[model samples]
Target: MISDHILLTLQVLPILPTLAATNLRQRISAFIHERTYQAPPDGHVKNVIVIGGSFGGYQAVKRLTKTLPTGYRVVLVEKNSHLNYVFAFPRFIVVKGHEQNAFIPYSGISKGALEGIFHHIQDTAMEVTERFVELKSGARLEYEYLVIATGSSSKLPSKVSSTESKYAQQELRGMQDKIRQAGRIAIVGGGAVGVQLVSDIKDFYPEKEVTLIHSRAQLLHSFGPRLRDLITETLTGMGVTLRLNARPDLSSETNTLKFWNGDEEMYDLIIPCTGQQPNSNIISTVSPASISKETSHILVKPTLQVMDDRYPYIFAFGDVAATGGPRMGRAAMFQADIVVDNIQQLIAGSRNLCVYKPKFWFEGAIKLTLGKNRVALYIQQENGQEILVDSNLGHEDGDVKSQWAFFGADAEELETRKI
Candidate 1:
């Protein structure tokens, strides 16, 4: 044999080659194995995604996340940074004198603080595909369950301005300034919004002339004759001019409103508390079949799931969804409960889908502040009509405090999940 050093070197060289060959063979085997067995579907995890983060959307996301299991993911995609309380819009216009009270920052609901139960995506949704939603930023989110709670937007006069929330706030401020400067204000539309706004304005500025113009012959025609007469009488007593069956076509410049009616009365300001259109463009793009032909509202099954199988994973609620009942914030919250229940059932692999029954007998309460100490109350009846009730008490009097307490409880629940 050769010397000991030479003999060792030769043995080491042969072992190195053997090790390299073995490693190469293992790599090749793994590659072949990977190719032979395709990767499993990435849709394994159960995900619940909610689009929109306003009142109805926010409540839905909060309830769903609270009710969902630990492993399930809940994603809330919202374009706005804050939640605007639309119900308080009139109050902001009258007392608070600004729209700031309507907006609340959404950071109150943090993901890490909630143990990562929910994810907040701050972006506008562009398209909703069969299994994914494409964001405006080109990011795609895949969801097993989807909730579309996009609400409605106000349709104002062309001169009034656009729907930019900032612009809306500016417009409200302008209106407030005009209210202080002018002696007469005319409000068109006798719906809840119009009536509430007029009530608040008259309550604060009692001396100012407030005229309510309505196309209908009576106030709140939908609520029946007795209640309408009562409300009309109340307004008249409060020095509010009620012009029923008066259709005034509006023409506005920078400051004054000219009515097309024969009177041709010039108003210091004309506020159109007209109707609203559902923000259903995204739904239309995603599931056109799910929307009703007559009303742009989305049609959903009893389970709140979209009627089209293409979006069986998608569900809708709020004013935009046709739930076969009155579309109100309260009703949306009620439907959210059913949505939460059905989503949980789906995740638990249960075939049972819960039906969402509209509470026709549910009487919605209405409170309108007429002046510093005067207010009006209207409660719905079993026959789907609003009846005039007493409204002399403040928050501390009678059931007023209890009513506020209930509202606070629901608000706290909503606040706890803000993000």
Candidate 2:
């Protein structure tokens, strides 16, 4: 209906306003930056580099970028593309298809929200020095301050391969496939993971014979006798065969497990949920003197900094660093606050080092699910004693909702602050 020139003008006219608005926004931003972030002749902008992007690493990066003032660069290097919500792992496996919900894209947290200052490297950190970090791809990044939030690796044979997204998912798939072919399931190690695995299997597959073997005399030795007795009673009631003070002598074909009590048993599927080792190799490579060979964790000062006076700029947190306390996720998150605070203080040219005192009440509460719609909550006391608390709720009850909410809330918080 219109001439060619008129049609062209009308189409291009819409784009003009967008360009004008974009230019106006840019001009406003530039003017605001010029007024607020103008550096003096001697003032130099410092850079803060964060290594690792898992649980503790994500928290450290998020808190640093959110709290640190303008004129700072924060670099986050992580090998994984997506941040996994591992706490919900056990429940995800029991269901048919909930694997996607367990993993959140790391890109959800944009750089602009992180103070217009964030760099993400999708590579493993090969080494970390006082001033630079070397990536596995042969790229070296320089930084003013470094935070090591590297967590620990799961134990193998008992642990599913990292190739799988969630440990529970892998276990679920393996169990679904193996249980059909397996006549009996033998789980070694009486830790939380092992006990939880047994519960999940017995709850879902009632016909399957599940036996849990542990080297210790009772379950959860660290939780004290009362709590341990509760766990033993719950597992026994769930139709789980408990092999106490037993060790399995592993063989290739037969897969025979032998206990110290001269008892031998054969298993169709053997899973060992023993322990995990910290990924402290990066710290050890830089400063071996700061780590204890016996504990395999770096000794950290009260300020969450590595105990090396030579390199005051380096800090470590999470499971990789031993803060004279038990290594747990709650502890790591608490330590992340201290790490971020100390980092902020250092950046502001303040020498005031903050001390991190562990709290008994906030140490962390453990909730273990027994097969028969019951869960045990272990509350720790100030005097290092654990008390057993119990709750009864099935899979469809509010307890599951609360459990997912707790894990999802933490995961969402981390994912939102990720850079």
Best by lDDT: 2
Question: How displaced is residue 78 in candidate 1, in Å?
Answer: 2.0
Q: Which residues of candidate 2, in runs, are more than 4 Å off?
A: 1-45, 93-95, 155-160, 163-172, 250-254, 384-387, 394-419
**What TM-score does each of the candidates earn?**
0.76, 0.79
Give the whole-model CA lDDT for all candidates, comma-separated: 0.67, 0.68
Stretch of 10 with least lDDT, candidate 1: 395-404
Over 1-419, each residue of candidate 1 has an lDDT whose tens digit, in order, gives 46434543543465577558855764564355334432223454456888887766876776654555555667889877556556656655665433543455565454212454567888888888877888998999888888988877674321123334566667667666777787888889887677767876787788899999888887776665655776677678878998877777655454444444656677877888777777677867767888888878888888888888766578898888887766766678778767877887877789788898775434144555544555565555465544454455542111222322333333453444333
In terms of TM-score, which candidate is strongest? 2
Per-model C-alpha RMSD: 22.0, 14.9
- Candidate 1: Cα lDDT at 189: 86
